[model samples]
Target: MSGIILHHYATSPFSEKVRIAFGIKKLAWQSVDIPPVMPKPDLMPLTGGYRKTPVLQIGADIFCDTQLILRELERRHPTPTFYPGLARGLAEGVAFWADHQLFGAAVAIAFGAFGDKLPDAFLEDRSKFSGRNIDRARLKQQAAVMQGPLRAHLGWIEDALADNRAFLFGDAPSLADLAVYHCVWFVRERARSDALADYAGLNAWADRMKAFGHGERSDLDAKAAVAAARAAQPAPVRGTVMPNALGLTAGAMVSVTPDDTGRDPTVGELVALDAQSVTIRRSAPEVGEVHVHFPRAGFILVPAKA
Candidate 1:
């Protein structure tokens, strides 16, 4: 196997981002289908408590959040760069906007359209996951309210593609393209909406993005994925913690939690830190010692509470 094992469910929008990136890189990866809701027993040992879809697991190194995951992938496979013609930070910034702002609008619209038909389990799970009530009636109202914002957000993409470039940045698909694609994919593919029907250029771009496909995928049992982590060691931590206001140092106990939804903290000994990402060493019998990485933005890191 290629050692790239992704623990993600089929319909996850964030997972779709990494999958399409995998397609862009044309790399073979192993798939570990995880639950769409809570109680991800197999994933907890690897991630500690970060409960998000589509975590990228390479050996004992666990990458949380698509922001850092795509960066890690690019670091490992540089041939088809995700930055393309733009600066890495600029490309990543656009991706951050698409992931949070655009995705929020898209989700509201999606759930608004079909939230009533979804199973109670999913609704209940999302309520807990997002730290809000997932009422279908409320969602339908929010979806109605979100239509304008969603269209406005997609309008930016439409204008970007007005030049008829192949991808967001230029000839090749960049991180921005992948980030934007997943939200649009969620709206159109999962929700089956006509949200993008007005944007001919955007739809054309979506067609090209869809053509990438999800690379070569083969299923691997979740148990085997845990075993793979147990059998291998995390790549040695490199570099020093960038001097920060937090005064965080290597080997200190710290906790990393998402600033947005699913705010479960993963406490561990800090391993590596830099401007873009943070790594912590966490251990459980299920996966032994694993290094979990999260992006700096959208995550709050602090000294673990005593």
Candidate 2:
């Protein structure tokens, strides 16, 4: 086993982003299918209360959020770099735009088209997860409003590819391409609707991205994943805590929460902190001591309350 286990569902857009990256890197990994909605009993032991899709597990280390997950993947396997031509900063900026704004528009368009067909339980779960009323009627209304935004975002992509570049940054698909592709994939593959029918440039780029199929994967039981964590120990902390406004120190009790949807908090002893990411050590009876990592940009970190 490569010891790389991904906890995600099949249709998850974020999961698709990571899956395509795995394809780009040509990596072999273990897959642990997780519930699309809630009651992720096997996952709780690794992530505490942070209920998010597509958590990346490496031995006893848990990486939450796709941003950090992709970064970690690059750190581990840098042969086929995600940031070609040292475009890390620019690629990450593009990823941020696609992940937030473009994703919001794409998902709205998707739900608007198919929300009526979704089960009540899935709708309810999504509403709770996003802290919004996610009913069919609301989705239909939002979808109509989001069409222009989605079109505009796709227009940007079309403009970028005007020169006939193979990928967003260059001839190679950078993280930017993966980030944009997943939202587009959700709209077409999951929602069964294309945002725009005739963006020649954007359509061609999408076709190229789709060709990078997910790399080698094998299924593993959820129970077996929990057991793997229990059998291992977290890697030694790698970096010192960078100076921060919070004055948090190593071993301080702290909690990390998403600033956006799915805002559940994960509390642990502060183990590492840097400009790029944060790590904390937490223990569960089932998984023992595990280090959970989160990207610093879209997450809120603070001293854990009593």
Candidate 3:
């Protein structure tokens, strides 16, 4: 319940999800700003191989992906629960749809709109990370094609807020608002687009979400974070063992990889497996032994040698 270390850069859209969750919960946390792109040497030690931004670390427990991290945060501090029964199903479904479809389109547009403005090194790193060539022409072309779908997506959201609801699902802000807000934040702030200006309802909703603010944060350097991980011990878990759906079991060597673009795997000794999450124990001289958690929803857990 101590040392809430967040390995995140300032502008990662997914990181904003976790940050907004922290704000909604009013959680106090420490920050370790990582690079926006790859070659995250300090972060690699704790995550084993996963290099995605905004990793959540508590003591020696490392959590990859915002989905898992937000749930963990909710678990640790559950006063204002994220899943209100009335809109739980709607909140989760719409959030997932937005996270993937809407988010992907926004990123494509950003790359296309400003790909030429990016530094060559940043473009090279993104290409390597994406496992594809950085085709500026292709991205620019895709940008034009993507606007229709993107606008349609936003229009749907605008209609959702047309009722003048305080939040997407209800009177109080929930994960649904947070999930959609980050992408809108990206298109408006990061990508610098006025696409939402015409949509009064969505623009107002975006303003309300933004006003929630990022929670308490204190900066920590990469070396300090590495040292913190080395000095800490993994948090104990009493998670019940369930059936091995993957034909795999605890103590097996496994690799946890995201199904999305960041296909890099985090390989370790499987310590716990359940329907919701998979925990793997990995060790490094710098970070000692760490248990990294990844949600089973968007990630794949497979035998290491497979």
Q: Give the local distance difference test score of model 2.
A: 0.92
Worst 10 residues of 1 by lDDT: 83-92
Model 2 misplaced regions, further than 4 Å: none
What would the TM-scores of all predictions be? 0.98, 0.98, 0.95
Clashing pairs in model 3? none
How would you encode candidate 3's per-residue C-alpha lDDT over 12-109 as one tens digit per residue? 89998888888888888898889887788899999998988789998789999887887788788986878765766677777888889999888877
Clash pairs, model 2 backbone: none
lDDT of 1 by residue, 1-306 (tens): 228999999989999999999999999999999999889999999999999988999999999999989999999999799988874778888899999999999999889878888999998988888998877778878988999999998998899899989888889899999999999999989999997798999989988999999999999999999999999999988787888898988899999999999999999999889988899998999999999999999999999998
The TM-score ranking, best first, is 2, 1, 3
lDDT head-to-head 2 vs 3, winner:
2
**What shift in Å separates residue 122 of candidate 2 from its native position after superposition?**
0.9
Per-residue lDDT, model 1, residue 85, is 83
lDDT of 2 by residue, 1-306 (tens): 238999999989999999999999999999999999998999999999999899999989999999999999999999799999857899999999999999999999888988888899999898899998776778888998999999998899999899999898889999999999999999988898866777888888988988888989999999999999999999888998888999999999999999999999999999899998999999999999999999999999999999
